[model samples]
Target: MNKASTARVTLDPENWDEFRSLAHQMIDDTVDYLQNVSSRPAWRPMPAEVRNSFSEPVPHSGVGAAAAYADFRERILPYPNGSIHPRFWGWVQGTGTPLAMMAEMLASAMNPHMAGFNQAPALVEKQVVRWVAELMGYPADASGLLVSGGTMANILGLAVARHARCGFDIRQDGLQGAGKRPKLLVYGSSETHTWVFKGLEFMGLGRAAFRSVPVNVDYTINLALLGEMLQRDKEAGHLPICIIGTAGTVNTGATDDLESLAAIAREHNTWFHVDGAFGAWLRISEKLKSLVAGMEQADSIGLDLHKWVYLPFECACVLVRDAELHRAAFASTVSYLAMADRGVMAGGIPFANLGIDLTRNFKALKVWMQFKAHGIGHIARVIEQNVDDVQYLVDYIRKSKEMELLAPAPLNIACFRYIRSGMPDDALDRLNNEILLRIQEQGIATPSGTTVDGKFAIRVANTNHRSRREDFDALLEAVIRFGREVEMK
Candidate 1:
């Protein structure tokens, strides 16, 4: 080949020094953004032009790294969902930390495929899983997997429960071949997250397989009604495969009586599973740990480190008490992935054998680094502060004549609505809805809305470690100002 034709092609930067400079500048810009996040709006609507810019045709050629970075800064950086904002309390989202952000970059640079090989990344994931299991009081020897979020975590836990308790070879014959088998069912409180029903549907059980047991006045599952339903289902020839208990309901943070629920599951010989997505982290808190007393007794647990542990997005875990049973549910023997006694392919059980994803990312790096950087004690204190902030808001609502506390604030979520005298329930709902829209549109603070007892409520779920008591004050002041403005309209 001629000299020109012999030139090699590579993705490396043409100028190493220039690329290094650009990388350093990017890191500096990120630090500046994080430090000054509070000065920006919690959220803002994108302008029409900014929105239209995304419709530009893809570049068939190439945009240099510098040009791409500039585009990101101009168009993407300014518009986020506002979960990172200090005043954002919307939908149980976590406000990430600087340390975790840096850890994410490091993990991406390494780019290790997490599907089990004899690699340090696999060991890191295993250690992270062990740390989470120990923190939640689950069995130390339990098998666990780091999943995307609460929904997947819950689904995996329930899948294991089904495999263990179905009394048939579910993996071999599938649900169709279970001839004359009783219809399998799952149970959870009405206050449970929609993940349970969605998980049932994904597992081919249909939504009808989930029995929505009513809750008590406090929003915890009513044990009496649950027992009665279990008896009725049994009489009707339905088999209860799993009993899901909610540790912290999304609406109001009301924890069910987990100990009693565990007892009931034992009595019925059903698998006990706890959906502790955000609340399970309370086990780290000395003051709040008592609320989730019986969670340790669960056959399996689904929890989110992203929400309560304040890690970045897409980090959650599902822990199963019986490691063997967990492996049996998801393990597959692929000839190509066959293990060797000693080589790059042999060490610990591949995470692929425990869950659905065979090609996984190094999601455990951020979790591991965050836990190491900030010890459990410090994290627990942050959680306690969040709960205290919510309690303060609840007390403020109780004292204010224009606001109503619609649900109990047991942990970090407070559900209340703005109200005026002589307004009917329907009118009040409309008024509060307007206030919520105004608060969001005005970029004062992002507090999500939900219906509590047929009344529209402004739901504040405080998972933001950056949140201060003053942020709640700002949120309340904006709510009142917007409430009056909407009422006048």
Candidate 2:
């Protein structure tokens, strides 16, 4: 047998003791960072030298775990986009919890493919879906699956809409191959997040396939106009495949009249989808549940657990009313993946049939642990506090003679800008833009930008549970200081 070969190979560490020590140290470092993160700057730009360090070519030989860990600690971990920081208020980001972090470690160790078949992880995922449906006031048997994020969730919802509404088998015939078909159309408000548009493109429907209906000053879609548009589309021989309502718009966090939209959808025999990415969690809040009143009526909903649910990055769910349609859109058959009546392959719901991705990680663990570790009441209270934090900003802005609100704050977003007497609109826009950049560069706060009623406004979104009222005070003070300094220059 050729002497059975003298050499041996394995990817495990050479010294288990050393590896264990390093892992413990890294864990401690991460905990320390999370514990004291609020004391640090909201963000800091990477220095040129540190940035250049990443430009090096990949190494042919693997570095020891210790060295790789050191590189991550010294370089990558410190220079993230800063969403984990309490004052990092850019783009409705979530701040993770230590409990979720521990759950993540266990998941990584097991490393199971969660894309269905009978296993504990898959079972956990199915249970999580049911829990989410119940939390959101949907039917107990509502079919759903966890996805990467809001974007993929939206894509899944639209793909189902296409299969269910297009009046043909879209899986095999394809959109183009369906001859003389009604030109597939989607409708959403102008203030809806861009992910809806991206979803249309992903479904092989061009941007022209969607119609952007106008929204009122609060950024909610005008229902009267939406009804008119639906009627007009039908009269014009265009197929209105779906009407997407935003539970909380990106610019101002305004919720559309969901019940009215649902009524219109039924009247027109069209699919109604809700982009409730962050706002879907509002269903958990007894005080705020009315804000998303008609969300449960949606044929499909795209909601992100990574946002208001406070899970780590990238955890979204797509819930569909019609289980068969959801499965029909993405399910595939392969001899190797054929269903078995018993054993590990016997679970009825193959998650691979529910949505995209044949291989998925254990995402439901973090979500389930997060919910169990902190009850719904606790999460609702955190979301309520975030809304209060933004209300604090609104009061501060109103008190300041130089600042004004550009849009109403219905949820947790505040859109406002600084003003100076006799300043032209163009100059004011430039000044506010500069002030935003200065705030980010100075690491004071990380509120992003958006246009409100054609005016450039600072869009501060308080989605972090770690945020306090004092953080809003600091952000307002920094804005005034930067506005004046740039004006003087």
Candidate 3:
């Protein structure tokens, strides 16, 4: 048994007053942290001694929950990867919502196992699927499931596509042993998440199996290049298998030309999959829905509620057009599980047999609660504000002599870099790296770097809802100041 479980068994949850008091203190502390987040440093400069303290050996005598709680408050919360801070314009991680935290507490209390229909947890999973399908404008007949986030969802979606094309017997036998490896081809922009490569590897499709397409000036996928690649692949006797389009890219927030990509996939009679891990929320905003145009045409779509919907930890949704293929890919005959007809659920679809995960957690409760507590319009406005904030940064970066745009603002991500005046190309690269390292050491902001067209650039992704015009202003000022300091040195 795990240490927490063994400790819990000995202490038991029955010491009601103490545990309740502890929980209240923890909640209050978190609320305070969120309220005062703007004042805290975006990141910490942990000393080597402080870092080594965490590596201390475990004690034979157990510490009480109260002590552990105090340690968490003192040590852990302060040093979190700093995703919640407003000036943290690094990667695409999302901030957690307070309403979702309450849902997490409630879900933990119930501890639902969302594998089969006999359990209440299974019903929770079913409801989540219905919510996702309805949100995406899919028919009530769709099938879906919550996973550990976009990577798993992509993997699951590819598994479903493979099974649907190959049939259920392939699951009984193996992929190569059953027949020739279907001349599978997947397409996405060069900016697509690395998770797609991982998904391909897990599915027995080597990394080289994918065809990376080019991007246009706005950083969106170049549909012309994609069409050319597909046509060439077909002419070369290569089997075109699937098209993976990006709904929101991880780098500069570039969306693939989903409308054109879908049309191309349709012409080739290939499976269309949209990786909308963070960007699909645009569907809620009529103004931004055009960014993900043609997403509805996807045979399967992957979305991350944790990113856009502001749920805690990792919760991803994988939706498929055909419900039968979902069950055919992942279902097993377990005597302990209830066997119901595919479409026989009462209010909506039951999602138990939709994917590979069986003993899933009640992750949907937090997302459901957050959606109900905060209307879709409110969240859409938050996203719109983030986009505006990024645009503000874009304007500031354009005005700065030291900074130049690597890619234009698309959605909420802007890629730019600090350029040294009169410095050689290689020297400018070193200067930019030095500024980034200096800015990180200062701990006022946390921005990351990426290569754009073979040049090192800083990526400012405005995903946190708390980010405002002032936050962007501060970040721009910091970048300019750091660039000056690095150049002077």
- The prediction achieving the highest lDDT against the true structure is 1
State the TM-score for model 1.
Answer: 0.97
Q: Give the alpha carbon lDDT tens digit for every residue of 1-489 in model 1.
A: 556856788999999999999999999999999999999999999999999999988799888999999999999999999999999998888998999998889999998888889989999999999999999887778999999999999999999999998987666776577776788999999999999888999898899999999999999999999999999999998899999999999888999999999999999999999999999999999998999999999999999989999999989999999999999989888778888888888863579988999889899999999999999999999999999999999999999998989988889999998888888999888998888888888888999999999999999999999998899999999888877777544
Residue pair clashes in candidate 2: none
Clashing pairs in 1: none
* lDDT accuracy of residue 250 in candidate 1: 87
Per-residue alpha-carbon lDDT of model 2 for 1-489, expressed as tens digits? 477566788988889999899999989998999999988888999998899998778788988898998899899887889888888888788888888988889999999887787789998999999999888878988899999998899889988998889876565776677676678889989887888778788888889988899988778999988888888888888899999999888778999999999999999999999999999889998888999999999999999988898888879999998888888888878888888889878874478888878888899999999998898899999998888888888888888899999899888999899999989877888899999999998888899998888889889987898887788888888888887888544
What's the TM-score of each model vs. the native? 0.97, 0.97, 0.91
**Comparing 2 and 3 on lDDT, the stronger one:** 2
Which regions of candidate 2 deviate over 4 angstroms?
A: 1-3, 171-179
Poorest 10 consecutive residues of model 3 by lDDT? Answer: 343-352
- Identify the superior model by TM-score, candidate 2 or candidate 3: 2
Which portions of model 3 miss their true places by more than 4 Å? Answer: 1-11, 118-121, 167-182, 338-352, 487-489
Error (Å) of candidate 3 at residue 422 is 1.6
